[model samples]
Target: MALAEPFEIARGVQTESETVIVELTHEGMTGVGAAAPSAHYGETTATVEAVLPRLFEVLPEDPHEIDAAHTAMDRVVNDNPAAKAAVDIAMHDLVAKLHNLPLYRYLGLDATETPTSSFTVGLAETGEMARKAEAAVEAGYEILKVKLGTDRDVEIIETLAETVPDARLRVDANEAWTPKEAIRTCRALDGLVEFVEQPVPAEHPTGMARVTEQSPLPIAADESLVAPADVPAVAEIADVANVKLMKCGGIRPAIATFHAARAHGLETMLGCMIESNASIAAGVQLAPLLDYADLDGSLLLADGADPFDGPPVPALDPTGVVGTGARRN
Candidate 1:
């Protein structure tokens, strides 16, 4: 799918990408899933397509072998979280549909307790970012996650905060800044933003800590926490943790990391790569555990062929997401 608007980060820019989508049918109960392989994580559509053939072999008709299918794929491959998430989410959808329950109900989460997700305002020229920020709020987003680290980071946030003062604004540098730049940037936009995410690169754990210490707003780690194994390190360093299913494999590991973050007294945000309804449905299943949410991938895509429809799954107001995880038309 093509991004309705360009999606840019410190690493590069994206306008379109080929994502892998899957359909796992059992007893005629078809479960759908989408996997958006991220170049940042060193994954490509070809790689995801290559790894998924193994699912047909190992996904026996246990019906509820969600964990087993994910595990089987992991044993065969090392680190294609997005690819594994495709099978992981389809199995979850299958389990829920087979039980005649919504995926959230199947997971036993209270729908009322799920937090509204934040809409993203991808990095752009200052004027364009302001317009997108305003548009997202007008579209019913209470929370907004703005991409930062450009020379105009301050200008962009200042413009957005001015445009939507009451709307909650958050900033992500996407590992673009240095320790000093992060601290200075956060200090400049302290009250303007709710938090600063991944202020520096994960490799610079020392820089992260220093930025965390100096920044007034809470500091969140995204690049630092990919797998559950990386949790302890991020927990020790940042005040908040961002968990993306694409980055961590799938639902089970994401939940494990969410609980792990809670145990470490860190705030959790369940985020996602730009995707379609299938994976967004799986990501939002853990909403009860998240302190923040950014599952706005499908909403960013450009048309009818995008394969996402309606609230909750595609969420009319992702900020007020509430529903089931089947293919909602």
Candidate 2:
């Protein structure tokens, strides 16, 4: 049986979390895993609840058979993203445990290297944004992802650029701007921001194409991409694609989307849905192949039990284990 547990986080905004837990019982051995959905993607408590019952029906008894797991996931996709992610991660965890392999190893990810993760500075006033950026920099995050798209977008970018002048910076609008505004904003912040994500709505790719063609900084699509089906359009308009397991509905689709993005000459980023370590761990399996990463959702949680959190926040080692490196200052 698998269950979803909800947690609350105080980040750029106060948000509720619903993480799914999968329980596998075979020959008296049990294993557990978790998944979380993105609220920005229209996932909610009720959405997760609606899909749980159906997911349990086809749950596989064996973890080694990726085919069976894929079939189950295909069925679960009928549900919302949160539900699908919960089910998919739980199954992956079970299979990895059954095989006595780390989840990342099971997925064939480079385990001995720790990829640099971008710490996000959520939407705030210019001064506050600068302070947050400074704090993240002081904490040793080499990359800083800023949340923009609000009315104060320009001021926020300028403040961050000044505060963490040397840090690699990326911005995510969460689809908060119109095409014209996106062009104006990206051009305005060109030198300061490394890239801007999903400035316009996902439904209007042509508009984004226009913005991408005219903008100074590169653009990455976040909400605008769902499955491999949407990748072609996004590739045409955006320079990068942000792949979230929750948004892609699960790892299967996320991998497919990754390959699709690569084939289209677009950069790839592994993004998270403000999730816990369980979900982040699943994402970590695919991190080695990504050009950019935003899997720091676990860092934003005020209270949560994460196996990855050691004496100091562990840097991802090449082996994909959490504790393989010296703690960063």
Candidate 3:
């Protein structure tokens, strides 16, 4: 899928995202999902494609046996979470459709009070980012997630804050700062931003804990919190846990991770890769369970670039929908 423009984050830049569509058919009903792999998590389109057939072989005969399916897939192979997520999402879509209910209804989630998603402002020249942010606000977005990590991170954020004073702002550093640098930057951004995300590397837990201990604003753990087992450690260092379907396998694991985060007393968030509506729609169904949402992956794609259509975003309304609402456009 082509992006509307180059999307630069602290880690790198991409002009297009490569995604693989996965489809499952059961009792004359077809459910669709897509894999938007992330190399940072050790998976790519090729890796997902390579492992999917094997994973498919282990799928339970019944869609409702999702936990069993996950165990079977894990036994067959180690990582390759994006591949597993594709299958898991398709199963959820299929099961919900079979029951004539929306995915949220099947999972028993309430959509009445879901938080609106935040539109991301990927790293760019300071002025260009500001222009994009202002344009997003004009286009009807009330919250923005700005990518930071540049030497001018402060300047870029300050510019956007001034440019759109009324817009809610959140900054993600994507593990770019040193412990000292993170603390200093977080203090500088205190009231100007909502929270700082993954300021130090996930491998450096001690560094993250130090930054979290000293930072003035809340700290969100993205890379630091990958699965349920990591929740305890993450809760000790961060105030918020950012869960991604691609990172933790899929909907089932995401749910488990969210519950674990809550059990450990960390605020929960759901984020996504630059994905298609095929998978993003599934994320939207889980919105009511989140304290924050960064589900603008599909919205970042160039118009008509996505091959599938799903739920509405920003608004994240799952009203009166059957299945996961992901179908070929």
Candidate 4:
């Protein structure tokens, strides 16, 4: 039997309130994965819940048959990203368990002892953001992603730069600006930030391209590159593409999107919605091939949720460097 459930994470302002958990059982081995729906993309808990029944109807008795599983998932991509991701992850987990290997190994990543991940400093008062940046740096985070697009964006970045002079900084506007505003903001924060992500809406790829060509810092596409179809357009305008399991629909499409980004010379960033470790662990499988990773959602949660409940797997160290182990840096 396949069991699916829901969860919520309280991320202020960017409150990610919905998640879907799926467990697939076959031959007494259970495979599990979690997914979250983004309201920004017209997905919700209800949408994922509505699709779970249909997914169960098509799941085959043999979980090891990857082709059959993929076919079943392809049939459900139209419903919602969260639902699709949940089902896809469950299948991947099943396959990994069948081989007695970690999920990252199945995805072709070398297991490392630790991989350093960035800590996010959400939108807040300039002083508050600066304090958070200082605290995060003190806590051993080498990279910081700042949420922007507010009236005080300049102040936020400026204060953060002042607080953490040596830390690498990036900003995500979530497509909250007009082309003119995006250009202006990018120019203003040019030297202060390493990269500015999805400043303009996805529909304005040409404008983003124009911004990328003129801006001092690199530009990354987040909401702009949701599928393989979006790759060409986003590549033309951006230097990087942020691939989220939720937004890309699932693991297969996320991999497809990564290849598409590589084909276009656009760097790939393996990102995630505000989700639990279950989803983040599943996403770590694609990390080795990515240029930047923002899979620290699990760390950001106030309550701990361990996706991999068994032995602790080696991951990247806090310095953004991969640790020595069976995993590669």
TM-score top scorer:
3
Candidate 3 off by > 4 Å: none
Instruction: Estimate the Cα RMSD of every predicted model relative to the unseen true structure.
Output: 2.4, 4.9, 0.8, 5.7
How much does candidate 1 score in TM-score? 0.93
Please provide TM-scores, in order, for all candidate models, with all chains considered together.
0.93, 0.86, 0.99, 0.86
Clashes of 4: 13
Model 2 TM? 0.86
Give the worst 10-residue stretch by lDDT in candidate 2: 1-10
lDDT of 3 by residue, 1-329 (tens): 89999999988999999998899888998878789999999999999999999999999988889899999999998988889999999999999999999999999988889999999999989999999999999988999999999999999889999999999999999999999999999999988999999999999999999998999999999999877789999999899999999999999999999999999999999999999999999999999899999999999999999999878778888767888888788
lDDT values for all models: 0.81, 0.71, 0.93, 0.72
Ranking by TM-score: 3, 1, 2, 4
Q: Residues 170-281, candidate 1, lDDT per residue (tens digit)?
A: 8889999999989889999978889999989999999999998888989999989999888788877899989998899888789889889888889999888888776887
- For residue 126, model 4's alpha carbon misses the true position, in angstroms, by 0.5
- TM-score winner, 2 or 3: 3
**Which of the predicted structures, 1 or 2, would earn the higher lDDT when compared with the native?**
1
Misplaced by over 4 Å in model 2 are: 1-12, 111-114, 304-314, 318-329
